[model samples]
Target: MRSLQPSRDVRIASASGAITDLPENLAELAKNANVDFIIGDWMSEYNMTTRGSQKVTNTDEAAFEQQFVDSLTVALPDLAKRKIKLAVNAGASDTKRLHNKTLELVKGAGLHLTVAWIEGDEVLDIVEACKKEGQRFRNITTGQFLSDWEYEPIYAQCYLGCFGIAEALKQGADIVVCGRVADAAPTMGAAAYWHGWSRNSYAQLAHSLIAGHLIECSYYVTGGNFTGFKSLPQSSDGTGLLNLPMARVREDGTFFIEAHEIPGRGGEVSVNTCRTQLLYELQGKRYYNSDVVAILDQIKIEEGDGRNSVYVYNVGFEKPPPTTKVGLTAFGGYQAEIHYFLVGLDIEEKAALLENQLRQYLKGNFSLLKFTTSGTSTSNPVSQDAATVDLRIFAQSKSRNDLSDANFLKPCFNMVMSTYPGATFAVDARQALPKPFNEYFVTILPQSLLNHTAHIPALDKSVRVDAPTDTVPYTFEQDIELTVDPIDLFSLGPTVIAPLGYVVHARSGDKGSDCNVGFYVRNEDEYPWLKSLLSIERIKELLQNDYNGKRIERFELPNICAVHFLLKDHLDRGVASSSTYDVLGKNVAEYLRAKHVQIPKKFLDRGRI
Candidate 1:
């Protein structure tokens, strides 16, 4: 076995490709070395419900992700020979099945790696018992009680911490599998095990948590999904596919993030890339995980002297809350969508006519019907495709028969030829097929009730871990009053109206039903101007049509020259039930970037634009 490094410093790389990211991620891992641990986070909020549904039909392999096993099988021999430890939350609901399958693969490959799995993240029984005892699980987002839910939950799981994983590693396990822990829990567990840190090491834990968060999404920190991808320096290979990110964490909990220094790799690890990932999916200034609360308001990202690296520092933390978040998924009926194309002249009028016809013919069939036009009409069109606009009609109902493709398509097909001059169905019949929808409900469960345990297959033993009982009563700092220092428009010269993307970079994502958009500037001088320019009112004005008077919360991260805005209930009822065209809220930032905004001539003269 490879001996533990005496330096007490740990290097962890994420091979998490989750659903469709397996093959490429495994290839990246095989090409890199000097990594003490490999962590793969495969579960997402949406996948949990899908896995739960699968469990209902196929109990044998419902909880395990087959793609994770496939990737690990290919990498198992090398990892075993090198003694590199592995931890992953790929076992969505069933760690035992995944563990057994992995053991079979190891036996077949003639390897002796000790594997362990953690349990207690499945809390359906606990939730049901709590309900029986008159405990009404209040919805964290909607402020509604669980008793108000229309459907029965199929599965429920609580977010777990890393203590059980740490224990497994300490007991000589080479690989650890977990269920629905926090996305960053495996990384946190690996760091804690390497350095022997305790639950009370808030600062160290917080830093490690940040490190895990950065790498959890794999290539996200290495220019994947970055808005300013056009501005990032590219290598000679000329491909946008970036090397996955890895963090070299010190014993003191500070870490430098970088892509593998492989020759001809195409991405850079600059401050902008790191800062973009830091703000992704963030709810506010304070980011809460099961382990610690990271205060992102003061976090700093500095460029490193080394190529393709950035130093992350000053990540502040507070003690964790008394309870952790619990996510429950219930059947939410059915939904269906159909698409129509309106090409060339009079596209807007054609779309309006189509919606009017759809409403007249299909109004009573669906409980909720929405018509959205995708593409804008160009004033001076160069091609037919450029002038084409797609009108999408989406409907949802509790009755499966009402949402069936046969019933859903009747109205559209009936009026297709008679609708407009150049209107045609844009999608195939299969695209309009209705699918079962699931509702996501989140609440908090006391940490004490979680019976966390580490089960070692090699030793045939299981050990229970005590949850952290020390609760920290914490309140977020009051929102900073926006008093824009005011830029002298006369001295700055004329302002040019341009899309926000020309002058700034943004990253936005979903946190349940809420969406967060973080916008930042590269230079310090432009920050003050940006701060004053994009106030809550101005941001609302920019997103006026979509804002719909929803609660908008804004926070300033001056250290990073960034502002974060949270749009509550912005995604309807989150990704599972939301009828929005961009289900994951990934496009919110890009949409904002496309909005025309005023840029000062002096700032533009500096020439980063």
Candidate 2:
């Protein structure tokens, strides 16, 4: 239980989680966090398509993330003054462009900074060549071949390892720009370079990878999107929502995530918060990265010695995966949506009337026409909002003209006077215009085929970083056993019907169209009940309509007392094209948490989660 020595710890802060994150975050962390390096993650599955399209169009001003350059403009002076290093995947589809932008920013500030960029993630042309050579380019989720894909492939980007980032930093790179390196690669690379960890340092690399994953989303580990946010302390401005986190990674690979206490920041880093993030967006116990495969079931998360700090350790690792995952972006088609409000009684009838009319009017005009209704009426309601419900009509088609026709809104407009009582449209005619959506495909390419390179502009040098020589082949379908002390629901003495969130804390996230929700209890005694209660069938039952005909996979983490369920192909085609209301699946956990269940009275005595 020794305190972390700032001199030895490879301190790093997550400057940005996504392209939409504020640019000032980099400056704030650099000016106050006193970290050795700062990292940012700027890519997502949807972004791969958008940025790739930008690149194809030669959109010079937006080929890369402008926010990242803006961030560097504000943080460059502070970073130079403090001699703090920086790394980011903000290059999106154009790493070279971002690299040049960084150099320009440094020169404009009259600062001496060695800027470097990592390349080899982009492989659109290679993938096309391989496809022509009979490489099926099979989809990982549905096992569908690329030939079966409806859209034409536009861009393909692979996930790279941390070696290139490490090599850049080793070659005196003050700023490292990257395109689609694994989300945690920057943190892993920084830790590896700081301790001179070898490529074969699987255990240490795995630990750092987990540490990187914990803080990669920035505010997530600090309290953002956390279920227990109500308990967090509010800032002077009366908002506890905005926050930032930094990690103190030891040479031994152990780390602690703490809120980077700036003057106006909010949020805390506790064991629960850390556990929530650790359980976010994972497929199972094994977290596969380009450099290492982390076995996460045995890991432990605990309260740290300092306030707003959570210690994480005990991670296991194996050699990296032989094939790296790749994302291909293609234009799905055009889509249009309209919302209608149905008030008070006969809500279902109102929705039914509109759906029937719309189906009659536009029956074969679109590829897909879907209707969804949510919200409930309270008995003896106090306000008009209480009795209001939402009915959404979503339509998608291969032909943009199909949805853009003036006749598209005619059915909606004609029914205004003939619709159910208290029915009203939520948007104007212009809001119903068609917008294009991208279809994202997940595949894999052999690591040996990639030419990962690290280039240092200041030194005029390029270092070739090869993929890992030692690797283990892995498949997500690998049999992972689940063992637990079974608790019979009927045998439990008495039960109180309440929302599952009363005794369980859960986190949910998306991967493509698939969603994973991990549920954990507050104490060990409640774990057995959690495991016994949340079966694959039970999860489908709780999900109700959303679980219709979709696959569900369940796994257990006995060490953390958690049960994880992966809902395959649940979000349609992910955030960009998903028709579901919970597009990113962020709300799936909350929705499941709200489902009432028969809970043991004994657990209720212990209080809410």
Candidate 3:
């Protein structure tokens, strides 16, 4: 495969539009950004599930996508004139229109969609195939099938690896548009593509993931959370942008992230902003990187001579645990809630009486999902001494259940009115409160798991970016390759202990025959035992026990805290494949329970926190 081309002096600029469409501010910000690919993230449910109910479709993100795109589209020619690139994930869930227009520009208009994570429409078909093979799981919220809907997503990219974005550039795509991808994908892809980094080099990959992580959230790195970062130039404006300036440092003992732009409009350059980003979520001894784990203990950052620029070096890494996969969704509903406090001299009696009183008023077709009292915990008790009792009333049913806000309203009203009459108490006549739908997210795993009963040919038409490879062939010591395939994404696995759940999502790495598996796990919970289990040594054991591959090979998993592993060449095409990892048994409910401890009300009240 051709290596990514070098565009070392590449400078990037971006724009962030004001909430009410402040094009000028956006334009100004754009001028200061000096970004290669301008990005806009507009999605109500972006951090939410990608595919779920039809009621809340990708269309939800459509309007914003259009707004941002139109903003860029309007400014495109000027950018083209200045030789600047524009891109955005603003298209969001329903990306058909964005995709169509982008194709028109790159293929017809001669503009580059400067983006990193772009999901091809073809992948959507992968989900259907999963269903046929029984790999697709169902997430009832949106009536969405579990497996990552490879094809349906107008934007279904988890995170863009380096290869593709660089490939697009080499193919002459000046402007690139992407679908749903990790916030950092675009920036990293751009850097690697511009740097001529080979796919095999872990260090560049590390740098790429690091750069991507910082810029991923536009202001997040710049100044969003620079707790003590005031070293570089500071922007006078309170917004993160207003700060002093400096030049940033990198692993090569050199400074990289720069805030330099046209004159002062480029704003302040500072080490503070960059430093905050570098140590944003530093862990003990080790800092996480996208490619190789970094031993933060060995890491260091420095600023420049008489100016703002921070430098990084000596970053180290740790072995990553297996990957886990989760899906995005939009579970829709309109709910009604009632909140009140039970008041009486007797605490337990007040609670019971409130429950009884409410039950009497609930005389309709709708069934209640929950009706309970609060201040019930023992360890961290909500002081109810002065208040007698506090109760919360709620119920949920299908829209077809034909229940309305009135069913809740009337019953709750009646409870207040008649409670004092029967129990002979006071303080009942007060207005009732209203609540919206008890929004819910029913998260399950492995959209589906199945054995291919038949062979399905590849459907490659518009784009021939031959499948990306994130799978790896694992062998313990000598030689053993487990179809010990990759982890499950949209689809849920048997045990919530989904062997590969940590991997957020992955695609083929390159044209290389080896499939590099990409695994992701939320960084907040880096379980020590599990982390230890995924040690490079253990992974070899797991891989060897499963597959018969080149034995005695170490694997790659970076940032076990936010663990994502890349398994290379572990799957077999056609009819010959088998592994405990590859064989899946589906049971949706049990899978959900594993994600959280199911404590009954009794357990919740009686057990310790």
Candidate 4:
């Protein structure tokens, strides 16, 4: 059998956009000669919950994602002919089913391909045994015990590392299917397998891990979903759907990240775009992945020679964790929401009246009821749409009967005839129907408990991979205090009070229920002021309207002139169960940027602001 090119350099590309991203992009990825391997991340916290529910309602074969198969079918023939391997976590909860289906697709196309699947991330049995042994699966976000949940969990899985996938590839698999592994595990596994890196090659593994993290969201490292997106150079198409990102990784662990340079492709890759993704979902300086713990404080990014390219380097890593993180999803309850539009005069008064009516109608039926108003009504209305105010009310309860649309939405609809004139429903009435709320529980299981294995049907053999027995214990520590003195505003010549977006770029995301906001500046001189101005206290002040006295931790990445804040329990119950309008907290940083702040005139004078 032929092998990959002798060159130690490998180019890996990510085609999956988000957990719910379409797979059509894989067709474009297969045409690139520069790419040796392609990875698609098809699993997210919410995605896992949905897949788990599907598995419960149907057979294991129905648990696999068909979109992945459909997309792979479009690109499989091309990839096979080019000898480019594909890896994806689209298996969700059914790795074996996905593997078999992929094999059938390959064979049906008159192509002989080797397919492999990695498993053992599932821990339902372990969770059940732990429960029997009186072990409590505590909620990492709310600090509640699993026994407190209203419904038993449908599924439980742990985040595995890259070694299993690496082993599968080493056995000559053309494609690898994986269950719930770290989003970057496939990329790290490919790099390790290609370079024959030692399991303890902390530096190389860490670098590849960072690279995978950067491109895992496909074009996110490009201009997609970026706060500084307006600054990106436009393409001929004038659209922001930039070509997905691909990385040219060398054996030495250094890599150049850039998007496919097809003509008219949207999105731009630069230091700012890279910086935005580098801190996208980061919690603090210490980022934990199953493969290695990357110390992001010293990570650096620079412009690459290629068009719209950036180089990421200097990522440091420590030993792997002794236990892998486990995520368990339980049915919290039924949740229902209704949106009411209040247009015309006396908006505030109408809003108050509506809330009072809802409270009276839903006196004690729900465990949680929240009424939030969006789009303020101004004096002297210009237009009906402009004057319209949105009143969003959500309710959750342990009883499905309690959260039904009759109990939640009927009251609002019934009040429309009597309360505030011109009050009407803003969204489709179907949205008022109750839906299952999945509560997320995170914990850790010893490595020895998981039975990691890789199977190749062509060879009709399965290989059991042993967990690392020499894992090092982890010690928790408080965030490092800022040593640099705060900058004196008077030292600068003049200042202006404006939105902070003028001087800084920010990106925010959610990790379970915690919100991470990363803020960075373009000018090095402004770094001092940014660090001093956006302290923990100042951030809490800016978000004071939404602050709920939750724990917050701050960390600084001087190499990128950025500060990251982790807001614990800020997203309520996370995406699947959160009652907030912005469940992912993707707008947290944008909200901060819109806050009025004193900006140094010298920095703004550069005209880049």
Candidate 5:
């Protein structure tokens, strides 16, 4: 591929296989449209660990920014002469290595470019600071940070203010790299800065988040997937990271987002595509419109001369909160399973018979839960498994526990060993088969990422893990201290096997992004008093305090069983759920830690943690 001069303001060419072959097509499109900046959205989470990609330094993470740099290196000469600026937002999780390498990439090519990190350390620092303050749990919108310890950005973007880009151009930066800015921000900032718009201009920001969302995907607004298959009219192209061309600059220091396609690409934009984009960015719990304002509800659309343009105004914007987001994934090893089918004149009796037979046949290696069969829609069930009351038993331990423990699973032959009258075995499938092990992805709010806040109180409460009782009203923090030695933390009062009350158990399945942590308990009884002490607040408190002030307390640890605690302060309805009632759940975790020093006096006369 050769670099060619498309205009005095911008250079148009293909990056060959470096960035992608699409650059040539982009060059043709940019030449057709009066465009200034050519942005390439590169990388996504899956791209991070794309296995053997040269662009990424860490094999676990995808190397997209490198790809972007390599692509630009090919056209550096042409880009330098035309004063065309290249921008990309691709290194959201890779830290500064990607950003620094990009600067070096351009420099090595004899080109000088300015770089901005929108995600990485910027958000990490903020999150850490916020956590130190009071941020807790993973937020669905605005606050949640990147997951996938190692990942590639699906849409890496500079999210530069439209005007800011214009200035960077003036500053003579040949290229710009960013993590995430508003999609339209780069374009808007470029336009606004070039047009000399003020930061306080509400009208301009409103245009930005709207235009960003519109063209952030680039061609989506340009008629890439604008297809109204059913209506066969003007529709939106559901293409990802499509370029939008309605980016218009006005003399009044303001701009308008363009919803048009390449000048002569022969595509159609309509109310359908425009509205679809609106609905597309509406992921997470709610849509986070950039740092601007616009009357999205009042958005008007019109198509003229084969061009569908959206007239947008009055958009509202908010500054993102400072906090670090942590994503955790619980991966599984292996699993073993067994299936049993029982038949009888009484369905319930047959199911119960199978339970008894397995209990005696395999001693006590299984649990019996009535197979819940409801919500059966579709032409057939999601899986091919037949029979309504099939016992789905599973086991992980290979010891005697796996074959005969009360908590373990039973063997397949157990079914035939005690088959009922009409319990004829159908298609003899793998009877004592195995269960597929899966991992769940969940986000954690660690103190380090939450702004590094540590606030510990006096440790006047203590208990032993071996000691047992019903009521303690002690507080528990989700503080799983690595320094305290898990055994001691539990032995102090009652180290819990599971946090009591409502403990959110999330696992990554088909459609889940991360294993979510939230409340699952319906009542307080499921958790014994001592088991009900764990809570997020208490964890935060212990993290903040770290056994500093309030007289040290103590507790005890359990041997074969995990001690569970019920939280009082930390566990609340989702803050967005509107049912939190301003009640801050803090006691659960605090009481557990408080018992760290005084529990022996309260429950055990001689126990000490």
Candidate 6:
């Protein structure tokens, strides 16, 4: 880590995280933001299944995200005019179609721009071949063998590294479209291409990877979904919460994040905002990517010198993981859910009565039947709305006919008159129709087995991007344990029974069926207390209803004063298939925060969170 020559400064601005995210802002950002590259992330575990479903069910329609195409239609002219290169994982399941569509857009606009695409992420054939060769492809979270998987997998996609993107950018491509590349690959690729970093530049590449991960979700790093969301400032128009994020990366791979300086843009980038994004969807301290494994325990976030800016640095790294992660999706079954509102008196009894009635009246043989009650009716009359809670009935079956309105909804509808006092269902008769769901399985495959390639249409050339030659087989057990001096809760003085959010900021996200919840404190002195209070057993108790003997993994980021827990199989089969109310696990932190905890009374003196 010696002082080296300064490299070209690259400013990468993200339009959005998903295809549906602020599509209108792309043209404005491209026209105004003085950025070198503009990128967007359109793929997620849920998105993979959805996009794959489109390709499978309808071959006539373009399988890629249409919102991205519409956004590009407006932004492409500005992008070409400004020479701001664009890169996005908008291809989803069908990258080539998106690439061709992009080429068509460029041609139709009467503009000349070289568009490139990275393929080989779709590996259904490879997966089938490997399965035939005795690769069990066990589910990473549940340890279930793939042979036992009920749904037949129609699509398999491996996460690609940034090298393919870097090659495309280096080969004079003005735009690059990718399918199932690692979410952070664009930023890492842009930085690597700009800085000419070598593949063996593990530390630097690792830092770039971290930078990409931070900004990959657009505004997530710039106060969006922040625990301090109430503190977000109002835009010039007096409306609040509209924000865009950009990363200014240096040659050293260190970067500062800031909200796009567009007039009327709201939100701020602070240490906490960056810290929250850093802790999101992470499993352990060492974050494994195709390019390099980022050691995140030592990474630090600080308030930058400029307004609404946060600087990040000190990210350590090792060689890349020998295997790259892959997501295989399959049609699980048809699922239908019904909700009923129970107002006032004996809510629990009413719920029980409804469940019993439905069980007796149900005619279908369901694979999964779940009853979820959300919210607690407040005691002592305020408003009738305040005295109401929702009881949801979720039913899943392999046969769609079994979950139709007649079989599933009729039984619940049958209880309308005979059930609890003041009973009413939430949905209309038509809304109760069953819909299909997809099961997502996350596993890893040796990088050597992948045929990662980049296709440059302008040059009529296809380049093979080889997997990392110098890779280390990484395991979570190899990560060094972080040591923190424990704080004695009894010695911290009188405790108050209150919500943990009083002195803590938390964020949670899903990875396949697993969910990660990270808790962090603002003051450095409170780190030990926060760490000591949230033990694995305490977490299980807090998430008593959700835990259900699920495996949990805990890790710490001392630099950010954060503790993160991974609840395995907490969301059942992930967003697409999970019948849970909080299937995405975005509310897990808020749920945990609402749980009453014995907090140091002194901390309560800091005032309401």
For each of the candidates, the C-alpha root-mean-square deviation to the true structure, in angstroms, is 2.5, 2.6, 15.0, 2.3, 21.2, 2.1
**What C-alpha lDDT values do all the predictions have?**
0.81, 0.84, 0.38, 0.82, 0.36, 0.85
Return whichever of 3 and 6 wins on lDDT: 6
Q: Kindly list the per-residue Cα lDDT of model 5 for residues 1-609, writing each as its tens digit.
A: 011221221211111111232544434433444455555555332222231122223556544455555555565555555555565555544534565666666578765445443332223344345446775434332223344222222221112234334444444445555443334555555544444455445565555555555555554444443322233333244433333345444433233445434332344345445544443322221123323434333344433334454444434343321221232222122344455544223556665666566555554423222232112223444543332444444443223344432333324453564566556333444533433222222232322231111111112211111111121221112223221232223344543342221122111100112111111111123223233333334433533632222222122122101222222212221221111222222222322333332221223322211
TM-scores, each model vs. reference: 0.95, 0.96, 0.52, 0.95, 0.45, 0.97
TM value for model 1? 0.95
Candidate with more favorable, higher TM-score: 1 or 5? 1
Comparing candidate 1 with candidate 5, which one achieves the higher lDDT? 1
Q: Name the runs in model 3 displaced over 4 angstroms.
A: 1-9, 13-26, 32-40, 43-64, 102-117, 121-125, 131-160, 225-255, 258-308, 314-334, 338-395, 400-403, 416-463, 466-609
Alpha-carbon runs more than 4 Å astray in model 6:
1-6, 476-483
lDDT for 601 in candidate 1 is 77
Which pairs of residues have clashing backbones in candidate 1?
Answer: none
Residue 221 of candidate 4: its Cα lDDT? 87
The ten-residue window of minimal lDDT in model 3 covers: 450-459
- Mind giving the per-residue lDDT tens digits that candidate 3 earns over 1-609? 343334234444334412233344335444444445544444323222332233254434343255565565456555665655544455454444565555555445465444222443213344445457775554322334445533232212222233444555555555555544334445545555555555444455555455554454445344443332333344444443432122232322123555434343223334435543443322223333222333443344445444434444444434321211223332223334555665445556655666787666665454334565555434344564554445555554435232454565665655665554233222342212322231222222221221111111111212333322342221112222222233322132222333232222111121011222222222223223233334445444544443435322222233332222223333221001111112111111112212332122322232221
Cα displacement (angstroms), candidate 2, residue 212, comes to 0.7
Question: What lDDT does candidate 6 reach at residue 598?
Answer: 89
Can you write out model 1's per-residue Cα lDDT over 1-609, one digit (the tens) per residue? 122453866888888835656455753575466688889988887888788777765786656788888888889888887888999988987888888888888899999989999998888889998899999987766656899977788888888998889889988898899988888888888988888788888898889889988998887888888877877667667664677788888877888897775566677778888888888888687777777888888898898758878888899988898778898888888888888888777877888898888788774457688988889768788887888888888888888888764567777777887889967885576757778888888887877788889999798878898877777743322244463465653445688988887888899988777788999998998888787777889889888689867677788888899988888778888888898888888898888888887888777776643
Predicted candidate 6 versus true structure: per-residue lDDT over 253-360, tens digit per residue:
888887786677677778888888988888777888999999887888888868888889999998998889888888888888888999999999999998998888
Stretch of 10 with least lDDT, candidate 4: 474-483
In model 1, the runs with Cα more than 4 Å from the true position are 1-8, 363-365, 473-493
List runs of model 2 lying over 4 Å from the truth.
Answer: 1-7, 241-243, 480-483, 490-492
The candidate maximizing TM-score is: 6
Which whole-number lDDT from 0 to 100 does residue 277 have in model 4? 89
Candidate 4, residues 419-521, lDDT tens digits: the string is: 8888787558777888877877776776777888888879876888777765665433337456357878668778888888887999999888888999999
| lDDT for residue 427 in candidate 2, whole number 0-100 | 58
